[model samples]
Target: MKKDIQIPEVSNVYVSVVNEYNDIYKTHDWNAYIINDKDVALEMVLIVTRGFSEIKSTSTMRHKLDMLPAKSYAKIEFMQEDVLALNNEFKVTFFEANKMFEKTYLFRKNTINKKALQTIPLMEVRGVLVK
Candidate 1:
């Protein structure tokens, strides 16, 4: 008779946003809890929002953290702005340790009372088994 093996659940995941120019604005570790899982696969998403302005030039560009993975493939998209804009949006997708994950956002489309930028800093990571 063969025995059935159970895979442990993946949890305790988070995300953060880093500004390469300003270290002070960088977050070491932000809270982005996992809310969904399926068939030994875990999925998560996060967002970071902010605002900025520039003088001297009418055209402005914002850099966003798109896709970043330690050992997997990823895809990222910015739906709302072109190369020139004071504000922007971001969307990211990636696979970690063989599992899939994704994130998305839209920025600079609402009143000043709302957030201007969004980011996803972390993805749940796992180890692959070798035969």
Candidate 2:
């Protein structure tokens, strides 16, 4: 069995999230864009956690990129209701650098009274892991 690992931080990679709503069409849109701003190519594994109350859910994505071509973005989109959890977590690993990053956000605390459509940069991380 492999032991669970904890990694150190590697900066420059970013996760940008935007929320969109359509009142007339009754649609909810949540977009997550992972940006790699480094000069080297990256292999990444991403995980996101969402839920409310006792129930929880997770979504994962993995990709091998050609350096993200410098300042380009790869995006994933999901419905807003899917992330109803007050506390949301994002984990990303850069295979090329052998670094891992984790971040958690409290939706109710941060966006309770904010506009429905908003963009936030998840810069500060909760934990980091390295090989």
Candidate 3:
């Protein structure tokens, strides 16, 4: 029997999955970030429900997180040898302070964007030594 899983259409937090390559290790790295904009702490968990009856984590997929500080963010990074594992279905359940906990599903078909560690470029003063 096929299960019915719904992907969330909206969420209070912004989630972005970045595909990174480490030249040193010569392996692919995946990072997921959960950004909370509200003025409240949040508890989150990534749920992967693909080729299974319910949401679960396998050797290929894992979920990690607890509480995100108010107006702050949390990040989860993992290394996977299989690129296809990155496409697995995912969702997050957050405990909203003084409110009921909620779940948001993430629907990703392909690789997302590359994470820009430096949003703004830092300029260097060439040959300038401040005494």
Sort by lDDT, best first: what order? 2, 3, 1
lDDT of 1 by residue, 54-123 (tens): 5322223233333333323232222222222333333333344555544543333222111323433333
Per residue, candidate 2 scores C-alpha lDDT tens digits across 31-92 of: 55566666765655444544444455455434343444445556644536445434344455
Top candidate when judged by lDDT against the true structure? 2
lDDT of each: 0.30, 0.47, 0.46
Please identify model 2 stretches exceeding 4 Å from their true place: 1-6, 20-28, 52-69, 82-85, 97-131
Candidate number that wins on TM-score, 1 or 3? 3
lDDT score for candidate 1 against the true structure: 0.30
TM-score of structure candidate 3: 0.51
Q: Please state the error at residue 29 of candidate 1 in Å.
A: 23
Off by over 4 Å in 3: 1-10, 20-28, 44-64, 79-81, 84-86, 113-131
Error of 2 at 128 (Å): 21
Instruction: Indicate the worst ten consecutive residues by lDDT in candidate 1.
Output: 122-131
lDDT digits (tens) for residues 81-114 of candidate 3: 3433344444556666534444544434333334
Error of 2 at 41 (Å): 2.3
Q: What is the lDDT of residue 104 in candidate 3?
A: 45
